[model samples]
Target: MFHIGYIRVPRSTWSVGRRFYSSEIQKKTIGFIGLGQMGYPMAQNLHKATKSTHRFIIYDNNAGATTKFTSSNSDTKAVSTPRDVAAESDIVFTMLPASAHVRAVYEGSDGVLEGVTPGVVCVDCSTIDVRTARDVAKNVEAKQAVMLDAPVSGGTPAAQNGTLTFMVGAPQSQFEGVKEFLQKMGKNVFYCGENGTGQAAKICNNMMLGICMVGASETFNLGLRLGLEPELLNKILNTSSGRSWSTDTYHLVPGLNPNVPASKDYEGGFGVSLMAKDLGLAVSAATEVKSSVMLGSAAEQMYKIIAGTEGYEKKDFSVVFRWLGGEKIGKGKGK
Candidate 1:
């Protein structure tokens, strides 16, 4: 919500709420170290946006990722190792699965440390722990490199469309420096402050989202089983105080929201393993902080149940609704 003095500005002015917008101040030799599911399209966006004269060097563990990039954009350079990418790049970006993986990629042989130049910037967009992010930042700093943990929001569609949101954790200088490259891959990029705040923000927000997903699914499932019409119920809930992202935007129960994966058959949006991994991170962080994450814990179990069933590899995290006996989901991946 944007407002000037006392008057509220029109709701239309709202873009993706990214704090801090100063243009590209730092010129860089852009690099991508991890190019997997979400990272693949994101790298492509960057490669397309950056001038051909300034090549975007990419490295991935998978030979297929390198082949795909080489095939699509012949000019984009494919490197054999993370070290090679690091040695050549002024700014290195990593999009990986977990904290341990991030650590391994950074500290292992031919890692970022072996090649990152002094004053080069390192941005890790993996959804990981605040502590681990800080630790990695410190490790990278020892190599005289600036590090930012800029995790993302919105799923693969957002990634492909460049509508993804970035929660960036870094000092002002480094955050502003990477804007040119980040803008190509994300619609909004926030400078949320020191080393791991971006990761913290993403985890906390996703934990709440996970819980909302369960609540929406359970309520709709009960309503449907009681012979209530899902569409009518959805219309009612969407407009009423019960409305939420899950209820209106990504409703898990069938017929509630046609735009969501559930309607098309739960498929690749944010993967189930990803959600379970996030929930696990949330619970682990919660225990460390001595916080009561009762709802997050319950949501984690629900995801576990869904993953344990036949639906594991086929569906999105939202399919936890059907696994709870809500409705038997449709076959095939969401298109």
Candidate 2:
């Protein structure tokens, strides 16, 4: 059975396949695609946490990334295309960036679906739109393969440390099928219903993150203008009613949280362009449902402005702090 909105439809009503419980999953070859900033470290952690007997096949559009990763990880080999990765592996994982990339890797003549066998499982860990996630899942299901949308959180540091969190959207029967693989890649694995729910959860979470970060940055600037010391205001905010993950933990102000990207001239963290992209996803999803995300809409505009700033799109999103303060928030500028 499957869910369509508030209704439950029998499995026969859809063209989906039966769940294939394979004990060979433990020995199955694992294929990884998209080895960018987050994906590279994530694939590394998966290899490190797996058994020595395990085999891995990897692919990336960037030749440098493939060469760099394969040069160090002897147990893994770089492949020619997404099809090659899928052809050799029993289960595949993709951690791509955007919807277009995800679609290209899964739907073309040289795509993953073309190379997959029946009962194979394909897990996508990319942060993309819900419709794309669901559409991709349907395509995999049509081939008698299983698909799971399992986007992750915790960024590069957590990915490197093997402590990222995965929000999975899959049928109840499919949860156990992929739990071991997910556990190897992250500390937390949450089942967020089926099909596109994982992407839905990720979009909502990042939307709130964008809103809170902006609010925190603006409020901190306001406090500073009113004569409060950075440390003192941060201390008060941490204890006061305004405390949040943005204000108390990953504070946008530089000195307030030296561990965050803001403290380092916004060098290494989630980029402003990515945040703008996620915020755009939030607004689009809201519009589809006729739901009002007023703050999210405002946050999107703020990030769009920051993304337009010189060198700001690639910097940490906390660089919004620099923009908010009317400072030159780019390379070769004042601190």
Candidate 3:
């Protein structure tokens, strides 16, 4: 199921040649598509940030998600299709799951392109392949509308907290025009360059993250087998050169960080399958550029294994810890 959020404004707000009051801000119709785990919270934050005058529209392939959102946010208008979203929105944001989904939402029959008006700004937050991102942008431009590949980082927690980092690939002018809107759902908004660079940055980051998580899992597992306590090892590593985001902020040891996925049996966060997909993207990109990524390739394979394993595919990527033979340190049970 696909979902969209649309924001509408009164016609008088765009009336021709009228002198506007200094305090009168023109309301914009904003559309958000894809109301999955990350998208749901992102749309919630954006909807909260927008003024009451702006009409919000939303649609989702999952009818339950749309119903849940509308039940909470009564002002939002739920639409039937991506095209319907485009027809009523000045700005559209899509946060699909994969490259193929992004393509279908934009290029399929009765898709966003079919209903998009010239000059409308389209922003894609899906972490897709660079080629797909660029191709979609080109098609959106051919329709006389502006499109930006603005994939994000920070996972589900960041999305819910409105602190995700946006890596945007678009012209400076176009990026500047939408910076404020992006800020409503993120803490950092970086203009990464032309189309596809955002996806490039995202894939690179996730690839590194995947590698780091694997390394962290290996280290912790080895340490446990050597009679070193998980918390003790984590403390030493975090305070020493071994410290990295994987070790400090998102440690794979379950009881080390109560807020991270590891503490919850890796139920919610970036899924193992998603991480495997991103690693696959990185491997493909590396191959295309002839860049050697031995560790990345190895990490990709590890994630692929995890994704294929029963009961692990849908869990958080951090479950690599358990998969690597790390001990399960339940909350309040670890020293």
Clashes of each: 0, 0, 18
As a whole number from 0 to 100, the lDDT of residue 243 in candidate 1 is 95
Per-residue lDDT tens digits for candidate 2, residues 215-305, read 8888866766666667787888888898888777676777766777888888887888889999999899999999999999999999998
Cα RMSDs of all predictions? 9.9, 6.7, 4.9
Tell me how many residue pairs clash in candidate 3.
18
C-alpha lDDT of residue 105 in model 2: 98
Q: Rank order by TM-score, top first?
A: 3, 2, 1
- Per residue, candidate 1 scores C-alpha lDDT tens digits across 1-335 of 43222233453652212211212222335789787878998888877877443557899999998998889888778888888888877568999989888988898888888878555678899999899999999989997677999999888778888888999888776666577578889889888888889998899988998999888888877776666777788899988999998877777876656667887778767877788889888999999999999999999887876776774665888887777666742222211
State every prediction's TM-score relative to the real structure: 0.86, 0.88, 0.91
As for model 1, its CA RMSD to the true structure in angstroms is 9.9
- How many angstroms is residue 330 displaced in model 3 relative to the true structure, after the best TM-score fit? 9.1
- Which digits, one per residue and each the tens of the lDDT, describe model 3 over residues 1-335? 11122333454444211211112445557899999999999999999988464678987889999999999999999999999999888788999999999999999987999999766789999999999999999999998778999999999999999999999998666877788778999999999999999999999999999999999988887788777888898899988999988898877887788998888988889999999999999999999999999999999999999999998989999999898767653322343
Model-by-model lDDT, in order? 0.78, 0.82, 0.86
Q: 146, model 1: CA deviation in Å?
A: 0.6
